[model samples]
Target: MLLPLLVALLPLSAHAAERQVVLIAHPQVTNAALTRDTTRAIFAMRQRSWPDGQAVRVFVLPNNHPVHARFAKERLTVYPHQLQLAWDRMVFSGTGQAPSQVGSQIEMLERVATTPGALGYLEREYLDDRVQVITME
Candidate 1:
């Protein structure tokens, strides 16, 4: 019985370990401050700008990556398919547009770290000097 329980718990433990999403801002951005709620709202198009008064521009993956999957499952509070439909509806209605999609994590980080007002997420392994990490908590 203990063995069975441990087996089940192993996957759960591994999942918990994967919860982190490394958020990064452009290197030139002087204000590195961000709250998780504010970040989420900004990415969802529910909020507009950073408190320091920079217009927010979000970069996202192309919706098939495991990191992107984690983002949708945890942060966005909606599935990828649902988010896509909502994004498309907004684009068609002109309410707002979806965040610009980058081809991969490398591209997303590369672009975000250079573009003003840019934000993107990646695993910690991809971290580089060009981007300032935003604490999600």
Candidate 2:
């Protein structure tokens, strides 16, 4: 009975582990905030600069990463597979460049914190002093 109960609760525990994602930018990025559409554009590699005209550098985790999937769906309103295909098309067609890919959340946070004009998403717990949280408007 105990084993059966535990199995039933597994999905709940996994869901509980998921946290809201925050759009974090390097301290040097001039923009203080971004709209949902603009944020989507930035992640989609469609927008290359901050609203203030400063160059925007983007970072992302691997397509299969949980945080990447959540952010792609919840915040960007796009699926991870779609984003991957879009990126591949852009790279292949010479229309755009892909966002820099990091191996893990820790690496993502570290790169975004140190690189100027950088932007990436992180679960709330991964946030730190080195990066600024860009509020979604």
Candidate 3:
């Protein structure tokens, strides 16, 4: 009976691990970590530059994408729809521009790695050495 229970729980643990999301940046970025507030500001397009004065290039997957939704909710503490609404408001009011949208996680990884001062999130399985992970405080 205990063996059966352990076997059933194994998949649950693996699924949870697979859902983990991490913030990533271009390898040239000097900062190794960022505060959650600052990150939220950047993603919202309220912050335009890094602390070192480099222009920030924000990237994101579609609002409906599972990884996008998970990152917004778990990392940023905001719903994906809320982000979309904020972006729409800023765009309409001529106050800000929305982040560039990538079509898939593969594109997200490639864009962040190639673009200077780039910032985005990806699931752990998609991560590699081309980009650096920025830990959130």
Best by TM-score: 3
lDDT of candidate 1? 0.79
Q: Put down candidate 2 lDDT per residue, 50-77, tens digits, no spaces.
A: 9888889999999999999999998889
lDDT for model 2, on a 0 to 1 scale? 0.90
TM-score of candidate 2 relative to the true fold: 0.85
What would the per-residue lDDT of candidate 3 be over residues 1-137, giving only the tens digit for each residue? Answer: 89999999999999888769999999999989999999999999999899999999999999889999999999999999999998999999999999999999999999999999999999988999999999999
What lDDT does each candidate get? 0.79, 0.90, 0.95
lDDT, candidate 3, at 111? 100
Clashes of 3: 0
- Candidate closer to the true structure by lDDT (higher is better), 2 or 3: 3
Cand. 1 TM to true fold: 0.77
The stretch of ten residues in a row with the least summed lDDT in candidate 1 is 28-37
What is the lDDT, from 0 to 100, of the residue 37 in candidate 3? 99
RMSD of each: 3.9, 4.4, 1.4
The better candidate by lDDT, 1 or 2, is 2
True-vs-predicted CA distance for residue 123, candidate 3, Å: 0.7
Put down candidate 1 lDDT per residue, 23-136, tens digits, no spaces. Answer: 789886666666667766777776767777888888888778888878777766667777677778878999998988998888988899878989888877677898998775
